[model samples]
Target: MIGAVIGDVTGSSYEFDNNTEDYDLDLFREGTTFTDDTVCTIAVADAILHHKSYESALLEWCGRYPGRGYGGRFQMWLTSAVHRPYGSYGNGSAMRVSPVGWAFEDLEITLAEAERTALPTHNHPEGIKGAQVVAEAIYRLWRGEWDKIQELLISSYGVDYERQLPGVGVFDETCQGCVPLSLLILTKSTDFEDSIRSAIHYGGDSDTLAAIVGSMAEAYFGVPDTLAERALSYLPQDMREIYEEFRDRFIPTSSLEV
Candidate 1:
């Protein structure tokens, strides 16, 4: 979960930037901070930790943190009293789904919970699939089944791993536009930080892409202490508490790396 937060913070400054050509860019600086991605991820973790409904948690968290770059439709959903799914197929579902991967041990349960997380706002088929695939990928990596992710994507989602990346600055917010690219970046990353850098280098919807890929990378390559500590510093006290609690409850001791 911290991995996802780290990715969000690191990529926050370059969401739609098309001029950056340096993959070795400084990760954090002025203007770098957590966005809706981190808030929603923490909301998901809070829901799992406290046994609250996903919708309720999302409402509370999003209400607490307004104007954090929420998509137009989601922002409308936040203010409206309807409190229902909006049939969105945006990457928002995928960006906020890392907790589903960490909190469940069973693949079926994980997939089911992933669906539940998406259903509140992203009930469209592509939206649900985006959340499921990202959660499943992380869960599989958590279980040491990283080798199977490509096969799962190919067989189930028909993702062509060899497809070319979207051009820099080409923004596509839909699930179908970003999820496959995130998985492809994960496949090519050498470590946690590399996965983040790769996502930012690819450019479009940087924070969301990195959040999705970073969660999977965290399952595969535990975040470095420096990066983890730096990332945590960007979060507020409440978010940090939830992150620490989730880390204690679901994160495995064996995955820690020096």
Candidate 2:
């Protein structure tokens, strides 16, 4: 989704060195580039669009984008001829699952699809759960259940959005740490850009966190036209084409209006 891509590009520069809570901070810097988050997200959308196997599509895309700063286990999987689940519980599962939320009409189907997508690599229970929770959140947001969004996340995933955690700049990669924070950021956001800024403000694997937040925020508030165009400019032409086609097929045009 464009939301995930925009978040990935925006947060790429802040992954290390500088982490801030300043919402007015520059979103895109000179060295910013799409990472594994955007690559895998596009892979998921490609798989769904072409009716191909998730594993195969993921493997192909990972192969195509070898230097996209993938996580260790995922990097290994990309190179290995043997494709097997590594039982990882990293937030990678959740980061790449936004497409599942959009591809299905029903919540149950979206959750199931998310689980299936994660199982090929992140077969750990926590990984699957993380993907399912994010996918379900996006699905619910798309369904326009904004009023009960916090209640739904709390009751469903036991995520305590109100609990105070470490301050921004503490890096955490575990699904438990990042997913909840990403959701909480979304809860506090005022718009699509704010959602990404809020997530990045939390630091620690910022791109993945913002990608997760941005995906849900896109469903809830829709992407701003200027923001979307700026984000698209960072993507390759092929990716931009896929994104356009995917959005045309799945998201209604009215939902994209600012």
Candidate 3:
């Protein structure tokens, strides 16, 4: 979860202003800020902590952070009283699903929770699949099954990492388009920050791409203490508190300290 927030903040500045293949870019700049990615991630963690409905948690967070730059349909759902799903197949589901992977003990339960978390807004099959794939990847990562990660992703989702990435400035919002690229970036990375840099280099929905990659990277490589501390500084006090609580409850004590 902290990994996801770090990616969101680090890539926030690149989401709109620039689109370059510069993997050497700074991790954070003056414009960096937490976006919907971090908010929804914390919301999911809160839901898991309290055993509350994902819909309620998501709505509450979205309402509280109305300026987080959510997608158009989700923004509507956040403001609406009914709060019904709009059948989106966007990457929003995958971007916020890392906590679901960490909260559950078994793979089946993790997959179910991932789907449940997505259904509140991204009810479309692709959206649900995206969340499940990312959550499962995180699960496998936590289990130290790095050898089987790419095989599972390809066999399950047909993500062809061999295909060359699109031009650096390209942008895509669909789950199919972004999730595979994020996973591919993770596969090619040497560390957590490298994974984020690789994802941002592709330049499509930079924050979301890096968030998904960072979530998986954290499970595999663990976050560096200095990097984690710098990332936390960008978050508000309330979000930092939530992140610390979530870390205490879900993450293993030996993994990474908040």
The lDDT for every candidate, in the order shown, is 0.89, 0.85, 0.86
Residue-level lDDT tens digits of model 3 in 1-258: 777988898989999855465679988878888999999999999888888899999988888888998999998888887879999999999999999878889999999999999999999998999999999999889889898788866876665544534446677787877777787888889988788888877786889988999999998888888878998998888888889898988887655842
Better of 1 and 2 by lDDT: 1
Clash count in backbone of candidate 2:
0
Model 2, 1-258: lDDT tens digits are 778998998989898845465768788877888999999999999999999898998988888878988988888888887988999998899999998888899888888899998989999998998898889888888788887778766875575544534457877787777777787788888988889888887787888888988988998899999888888888888888888889999987766857
TM-score of each: 0.96, 0.95, 0.95
Backbone atom clashes (below 3 Å) for every candidate? 0, 0, 0
Q: Over the stretch 1-258, how does candidate 1's per-residue lDDT look in tens digits?
A: 887898999999989674798999888967898999999999999999999999999999999998899999999989997987989999999999999998997999999999999999999999999999999998889888988988867765575544534666678798877888888888899989999999998888998888888988999898899998998898899999999899999999865544
Task: Score residue 222 of candidate 3 by CA lDDT.
Answer: 89
| Highest-TM-score candidate | 1
Report the error of model 1 at residue 234, Å: 0.7
- Candidate 3 regions exceeding 4 Å error are 159-167
